[model samples]
Target: MSPGDEHDFRGMDQGGRGDDPYSTLGGTRQTRTRLPDGDAGHPHARRPVRNSRSLITITGVVVLLIAAIAFANRGGGNDDTASPTTKNPGAAGSAPTAPTGTKPVQGKNGTIASGFAHDEQGAQSAAANYAVALGSAEMFIAESRQSIIQATHDPAVAQKLQDDLDTAYSPAFYKNVGLNDDGSTPTGLTFVSRTVPVGTKVVKMEKDAATVEVWCTGLVGLAGQGSTKPVTETWFTISQELRWVGDDWKISSSSQAEGPTPVNGDNRASTADEMAAAVDVYGGFTYAR
Candidate 1:
């Protein structure tokens, strides 16, 4: 994929503002009128050409703009104290905690995915992506599945969850996904199983770990016309227990529960091509409060 496409995925996750001038075009600094206020040793005042009131007003506006931008990028998800916490809350005696709230941008500075600002959303985004990686089509394939499970999960829990999931994706489930009974892809149809998190919130927090619940509704199926195994959507909530392993948060354990789900909307469904194209064209987000 092109660099542009990769950038689109990053934008899709955060503000979804690919075209935002302030964010995209580098306008973190605000513009304001400058006044020549000679507040030096000379106490004599001179006639000011610039409107003092207007200068004050413009400065005030610029200050407000800067403050607003800072708030939006604060990474606390919002200013709310109850907003989700970043996995790493800084040392207590250090500067007040700056939280994480978005994904590590999968952006290539040349070819590297740009790192994200550490905050609450960042942790949740990483967790959500980890969830997707864990509950993916890859999980069925032994080697790839093992790699994914090992990479994202705590060792003990990975094994336990693996055992349980192995049973869940049984022969019937494979058939339904247009895969061979062993979860291999069938000819002409692409097998898909992805957990797309809609949003995430922190249920509780601890010094070493956090209880995060990702409310996800996923699409699972084959994306070819005239296929018996049509793509279907499923809703579930995955509550993950994340530990502050190394510097980043890792999933120590997780449990899935049937949703406090909403009823299906009356919106018309799209064709296979439409759905497939949409998935590739549009991207997912790093969710936060």
Candidate 2:
């Protein structure tokens, strides 16, 4: 199978750096946007100030509204929202999944990890790992791409899926992504396409089938001097419908959606050379949870 030929594999590399969820809960924190110091269209523009009494009244009204909303949703009966069971649902740094205490997959299926359990935990693990593989830099290479596809996809659809992906990762697509004719990086450039899974959730689980959503931040494009394609990051969620196949979970189908994206932080973007060195030095992870 040609590597990266799957239409579903497109946009896997869209990424940008932000607050590391591992280091802080601030990745998804919202902050107030401050206006620029100088130009207000008029150099002598002055801000209007409200009275202290009026400001106090507004604050009191805002607090009451919040209290009322909290009271209305206080019950554990809101089926429209994901309940805060394992953790506070929708909070930054919260795990959307419940713990199963099951260990990660112990075995390997070629380059991909294998030996997933047949439960919801196993399915979530499989989906997360598969997202990393399908969103990898290796997917642009022919041999490694085939290995990834075979390892993560159901055998029944692997060949056909490979053909589809082959058609999708055409020469034009490679050129668009700054790859050479053979999917190799241009001289002195480091092609960066990696998916870092932030969290996983089993949206729907059954005896033999599971729908798992893996929220991820990805790094894509190229890093090098004179390179126009600078590495970038993006937040997205890949939802995979997995089936228990041949004693392990395999992707039956998958799709990606934009995000529950967090606000961009104020961190200075790294230089291209620094990004290239980082990609070369830091190996990608075998994400488990």
C-alpha RMSD for every candidate = 21.6, 15.2
What lDDT score is found at residue 185 in candidate 2?
86
Residue-level lDDT of model 1, residues 2-78, one tens digit each, is: 11221221112323233322221111222234446566654554432333333232122112221222222223232
What's the distance in Å from true for residue 275, model 2?
0.3
- Number of clashes found in candidate 2: 8
Q: Tens digit of lDDT per residue, candidate 2, span 1-289?
A: 1211122232223331222221111112223344544564654443332243332221221122112222222231213443344232233544555555788687998878899988767887899899888778787787887888889887866776676556556676576557787879899999887778888877666667777878878776678898776665556677676789999998766655445566555455778899999998999878775
For model 2, the stretches where C-alpha displacement exceeds 4 angstroms are 1-100
- TM for every model, in the order presented, reads 0.54, 0.68
RMSD of 2: 15.2
Please report, in order, the local distance difference test score of every candidate based on alpha carbons: 0.48, 0.61
